[model samples]
Target: MTLILWTALGYLLGSIPFGVAITRVLGLGDLRQIGSGNIGATNVLRTGNKPAAFATLLLDSGKGAIAVLLARHFGGETAAMLAGGAAFLGHCFPVWLGFRGGKGVATFLGTLIALHWPLGLIACGVWLLSAVISRISSLSALLAAALSPVFAWAIGRADLVLVSLFMAVLIFARHRANIARLLDGSEPRIGRGKP
Candidate 1:
């Protein structure tokens, strides 16, 4: 019951579409109508509002971090992991968005930071390196997500490895279209706007 409650709370909190709300507030109109139709920072960047995209990224990540932190504080590591997983799920399939939401990369990173800062930092490094090398946002995200489980295990966070793997799987699933585009060398690079 405690796990269920914490996970529910996490989902509810995570489901808040900061990207959509921020763009709307900024008078950018419905965020879903533009770009890839995704309510994520990358999609928001298509509006050519760097500040808005940055804000959306921070808030999206923050919500996941907050969910994990609260669950850990009240329920301990196991609950924290559960909450983090649920939070990631919420971001990927937000109810308010008719089960369509972001790709979960930002939320995954946020959960990693809350679960284990060292692992989070390592993941960020991987993301940055990949982004710099490939200039492809989806590729960078995929590489980082793929490496998180290994980092968690290396850091003696066995409990988090499964969660990391689960998040990685979801991230990959969400990027299926991007994966196809990548294979065809037709995917849009970061800062090039939507593909």
Candidate 2:
């Protein structure tokens, strides 16, 4: 019963779709009409509204962090892990979005931060380094997601490894199209220098 409640809470919170909501509130048309038609921070960036994009990024990450923290406070470590995983799943397949949602990279990082701050920082570093080196958003996300589980395990956070691994797999799966573009040297970079 507790697990179910935590999962439901996590999913509901994760389904907020801040990107779409923020864009609309700011007078931007349907976010789905934007680049890649994705409801993630990266897509929000294409709207030429940096403020909206930053807000989306923070809120998207906050949902996952809030779920883990709430579960940990109300339940226990195990509950926190369940909630974190649920949050990631919700981001990937939000019911509010017809089970179509953004990749779980931001939420995944957020969960990691809640579960283990050190690992989260390391993952962010990996993301930053990858982005600086490659300038490709998808590639940076992929590298960060790929490294998260390993960092968790190395830090002796065995309890977090499974959830992180699941999140990583989902992130990779969600980036399938981006992966294809990357392989063919056609993935879009982090910015257009204008929008």
Candidate 3:
């Protein structure tokens, strides 16, 4: 029952589309029609609204952080990790947004940070490094998520490894398009204002 509750809470929290909300509120029209039409920060940036993009990123990350923190308070470490992972999945597959959602990058960062501070730091470093080197959001996210589990393993975070694994796999699945673009040398750059 507790697990179910945490998962549901996380999902609902994740479903709160910051990009959609902010865009509509700011009279930017539906964010879905702009850029890559994604509900993530990167796409929101394509609208030439830095504040909106930051708000989306911060809110998305905040939801994951809050979910995991709540689970920790209500249950334990394991439950916290589970809730965090659920939030990531929800962000990647929001029901309110036609079951299609963001690429789960920012939210995953939040989850990892909440689960383990040092691990989160490592994940962030890796993510930034990957993005800088590859210049592709999809590739950076894929590498970061993939490395998250390994970071957990290195830090002796046994409980978080499972969630990291799922997150890594799920992100890869969600970024199939990006992966294809990556392979074909047509992947878009991060600050290029989306596809």
Number of the top lDDT candidate? 1
Candidate rank order under lDDT: 1, 2, 3
Candidate order by TM-score, decreasing, is 1, 2, 3
Backbone clashes in model 1, listed as residue pairs: none
Residue 37 accuracy (lDDT) in model 1: 85
- Tens digits of per-residue lDDT, candidate 3, 1-195, equal 988888888888877788889999999889888878888888888888889989989998888899999999998877887789889988988988888888888998998888888988898898899888878778888888888888888888877788889989998998888898888888889779544
lDDT of 2 by residue, 1-195 (tens): 998899899988888788889999999999988888889998899989988988988999999999999999999988898898899899888999999888977898898899888998899899989999988888998999988888888889887778888998989999999998888877888875312
Off by over 4 Å in 3: none
Q: What is the TM-score of each candidate against the true structure?
A: 0.97, 0.97, 0.95
* Candidate 1 local lDDT, 1-195, one digit each (tens): 999999999998888899999999999989999888889899899899999999999999988899999999999988999899999999988999998888988898998999899999899899999999999989999999999998888888898889999999999999999999999999998888665
lDDT of 2 at 178: 90
- Strongest candidate by TM-score: 1
lDDT for 68 (candidate 1): 98
**Which candidate do you rate higher for TM-score, 1 or 2?**
1
lDDT accuracy of residue 48 in candidate 1? 91
Candidate lDDT scores, in order, read 0.91, 0.88, 0.86
